[model samples]
Target: MVSLSDYLILSSIIFCIGLAGIFINRTNIITLLMCVELILVAVNTNFIAFSHFLGNEAGQIFVFFILTVAAAEVAIGLAILTLLFRVRGSIDVDVTNSLKG
Candidate 1:
């Protein structure tokens, strides 16, 4: 039987890895978005794990909602990134500081 602690640990580890990637790579919007997705996935994994362990359907339903929002976030974020790349001719997040008013 998979324990709740085990699932939480796994999810935490995955989330940390994604965070590390986001911090280490200061540029590349696509990579950043991918890492964000990874973190979101990790969160969803935890939700599912807890739902299963506690025998509650609420967590699973929350996970579905999270997934739906993540999908929308990715879609919009990518579209913006695409537009930025087209205008700036680069996808470096570090260069975003130049957008200051």
Candidate 2:
């Protein structure tokens, strides 16, 4: 039987991995977006685990809200990235140092 601590530890590990990916993959915008999703997944894992352990529905409800928000966030982020790519022909973060119109 898995305990709450076990779930939390797993969540922590996943969260750290997401953070590392975001920090290390500094070149590609798509990869950064994926890392952000990964971080959200880690948060969802914690929410579900806590909901199960506490025998409450609030956590699950919050998880659904997070999921919806995350989806919208991804969509908007991709759209912006698409526009940036079309305008600049690249999604490299270093290129954004100069805001040219």
Candidate 3:
């Protein structure tokens, strides 16, 4: 039987992987966005696991909202990425830093 601690450990592992991906691969905006999504997935997993174990619907509801927000974020992020690619011809993070002016 799986316990809450097991779920927590799984979530933490996923979170760490996502965090590491972001830090280790700073060259591509797409990779960064993917890592952020992975982190969100980890959070959602925790919410679902806790909600199931505690017999409460609140965590599930929060996951629903988090998913909704995540979707919107993806849409906007992709749009920005598209524009950046169109203008700069490259999606490298360092290339974006030159747009400050």
lDDT string, candidate 1, 4-100, tens digits: 8999999999999899999998868788888899899899999999899889999999998999999999999989988988888888977688756
Cα-lDDT of candidate 1: 0.90
Query: What's the lDDT for residue 19 in model 3?
Result: 98
Off by over 4 Å in 3: 99-101
Write the number of the candidate with greater TM-score, choosing between 1 and 3: 3
Cand. 3 TM to true fold: 0.93
Candidate no. 2 TM-score: 0.93
Q: After aligning candidate 1 to the native by TM-score, how far in Å is the CA of 97 from where it should be?
A: 2.1
Identify the leading candidate in terms of lDDT.
3
Worst 10 residues of 3 by lDDT: 92-101
- Which model is ahead, 1 or 2, in terms of lDDT? 2
- How do all models score by TM-score? 0.91, 0.93, 0.93
Per-residue lDDT tens digits of candidate 2, residues 1-101?
Answer: 99999999999998999999988886888989998988999999999999999999999999999999999999999999999999999999886779576
lDDT of 1 at 63: 92
Residue-level error in angstroms, candidate 2, position 4: 1.0
Candidate numbers sorted by lDDT from highest down: 3, 2, 1
Query: Residue 54 deviation, candidate 3, in Å?
Result: 1.0
lDDT (tens digit, per residue) of candidate 3 on 14-101: 9999999999996899999999998999999999999999999999999999999999999999999999899999999889675465
